[model samples]
Target chain A: MSKNIIIASTSTLHGGDYLEYLLPELSVHFEHCKTILFIPFARPGGVSHDEYTVKVSSALAKINIEVKGIHEYENFSKAIKNAEGIFTGGGNTFLLVNQLYENNIMTILAEAIKDGIPYLGTSAGSNICGLTMQTTNDMPIIYPPSFETLGLIPFNLNPHYLDSDTQSKHMGETRETRINEFHSFNNIPVVGLREGSWLVVKGDTITLKGHLTARLFRQNQTPAEIESETDLSFLK
Target chain B: MSKNIIIASTSTLHGGDYLEYLLPELSVHFEHCKTILFIPFARPGGVSHDEYTVKVSSALAKINIEVKGIHEYENFSKAIKNAEGIFTGGGNTFLLVNQLYENNIMTILAEAIKDGIPYLGTSAGSNICGLTMQTTNDMPIIYPPSFETLGLIPFNLNPHYLDSDTQSKHMGETRETRINEFHSFNNIPVVGLREGSWLVVKGDTITLKGHLTARLFRQNQTPAEIESETDLSFLK
Candidate 1:
């Protein structure tokens, strides 16, 4: 079966309601599903899993879809296998990956997604769709057993990607600089997704979504700007 | 033996020459030493160790302190043991910690500093002085064997820390939010050091240096603004 997924840069856009920017797309993507298995491990603002799930539940309810927290299930593996749809919300990537490993659901979740349950991943959730979480901007509050992820896509992602402000006095490494440094140690490609951008994947086809142009960084090559609607399946 | 250390937030300030802002203090810090050993593993911008060493050499030359790259020595253990002073330049924290562990020098480096070896750590370098590199802002370009660092100080340092830009519309987690999430999983105190600020450790006393105030985050406590010259030794 062909996989269907919406890997978004963020759940909520600036000054927007939760999942506001992507509600149109999500409604269509999850049209046939009546429920979503919400993985709330990446708890934004460090909210509890139940609290995070409630936030997601309220948002998806706009499309008449019910949301259930994965933590509510007695057997996480069985939950992933039986879910009609899946939506993993954004939070800290390190904590998310750590919890996934702790629950031993990293691999199982990947299998279920590949088996083609409609999936939606925002921020930290989208980060795990990559080969590794090495390019994440989240603070390393907790260490996961491994840097490995689902490999749902060929490249890694730097979400909420920002261009360097030449006018700023801050000395922190810019998003571009951080990705360049990653190239120094590893050869994986990285997609720098701006706030409203996302990747829509269908089986072997992947295309950039939203209006913003994404920055693509490949090992030993200059970063290029990718326009919206550009097919990125070749990266695999 | 008493430890003498300078753990700074950055190596260079905006539009300033490298190490220019700290030269006056560094001169006094290394007054008794003529040659200093440099650890260039955190290769900022992916510069080679030799290249990074040259930059440090140029900066310290103003202080009459000759710099030698640690990579030059065949016996890293012996070289660190006999060094007059040690200076670890800033770059990628993950890379720095990985290299430290790869060389089996993480513990030795800590012992040397505790034994009264004057040490200077800027940015990624300063991060290692904490209990772990968990509070760093750098990308996880490589996986280190452990997040453990020198534990030279009682708490962690979040280098190049910036306050939330209330005017900006970007949705990335502010420095404060990231630190707050860290508090949820970890109990270690984190000092958010602005670009110009630093911490001065003399024996068991750790004081905030520079004119800027720092933000301190402790578990279950409200984040507080710390004034310059505030003695933070009690955090130990």
Candidate 2:
């Protein structure tokens, strides 16, 4: 019915070669769409993003797609509200939540997607879709002082996944065990997203990408590994 | 009647004296009781003492009173149930919760204290008493993955107090604000405890000390400074 959602590990400028993994997924929905709205207020982790927006725009232009960083625009309100589609890049989730809460952009962002404007969320952007900010393991280097988040998804997300090494002296609970603890105290399912991987939701079709596997742990039950084609709605 | 509850910052020997402000309140409680059972199990962030029982006993005996590290017992079953008064010390709470959950000691501990054992909990020990481990500001370096704590107190505990210095080059949020972020996700009250200070509970009596004022912050509310004689039952 409508080009819906693209949740990713990160946008092109965020370390990985985003174009190689993202372009194919994006073209599926945005085959005819042009003029993408980009938001970068989420990069408040003290990590400088000299030209995250410019870099992405340059990449999109190579594909004959027109892109613009609309941080400052005429009627900034209307630009985001009526955009053909929007792409949100990854950064510190706390910083993103801080702005979302302060600027009252959460509801409006949700509205844009529900209204049929294709929405793409990367890394920290995807985190805001969870129930609370507690699920994030990011350092509090940035603080919104509030955990309020955009609840586009019912579960928590552990982005940029790394497995715990069982052979080495690098001792610590594996990421799988960490997610287990959340469910020990909480009932929500936590999804681990590996780099270059993504969750694509269009209307009701949800697909996993990058051939990366995810693990799901629930209370009193052992963790189970999930592969591509696994339906996440049942988890909801 | 049970003796008063004295939550200390550490279970290591003499660490309790570091909290001189709590001494007066404990002394008053001692005026009415004869034996005090030191709880070292909560030290590991779990239910079983494992190897810490002998550790607590040796330390307390130096104080010229009868002290038994509950770890002396072969099992946690009889060790906790027989105690007339209990004190839980601070350490890595992850270890504590793991042991507690694995051994199913939380239910036993809660039952013993709720029946009037006059339980005292320090830092890690106190954290477990809360609704969840969400109250602790400890680095997730040793995360047990579960934030579910004892929930004995409705509020979270932010130990090792530090103030915000406007001149600080540290770009991240202050410790207080980071703790405030925790409250944003949950309604649990947060108590900022400075060194040498603690909340002493004897029967219905709750006293504060250590010459340092405490801070209490709630969700969507300005944090307020608390002083001695402050009725903190709102947290318990």
What is the per-residue lDDT of model 2 for residues A7-53, given as tens digits with 9 covering 90 to 100?
A: 77655433345465577667766666788887776653233334667
Off by over 4 Å in 1: none
Q: Which stretches of candidate 2 lie over 4 Å from their true place?
A: A1-3, A11-18, A44-50, A74-76, A171-173, B1-236
Give the distance in Å from residue A152's predicted Cα in candidate 1 to where it truly belongs: 0.7
Question: Which candidate leads in TM-score?
Answer: 1
What TM-score does model 1 achieve against the real structure?
0.99
lDDT of 1 by residue, B1-236 (tens): 79999999999999899999999999999999999999999999999999999999999999899999999999999999999999999999999999999999999999999999999999999999999999999998998999999999999999999989999999999989999999898999999999999999999999999999999999999999999999999894
* TM-score for candidate 2: 0.54
Fraction of true inter-chain Cα contacts (below 8 Å) kept per model? 0.89, 0.00
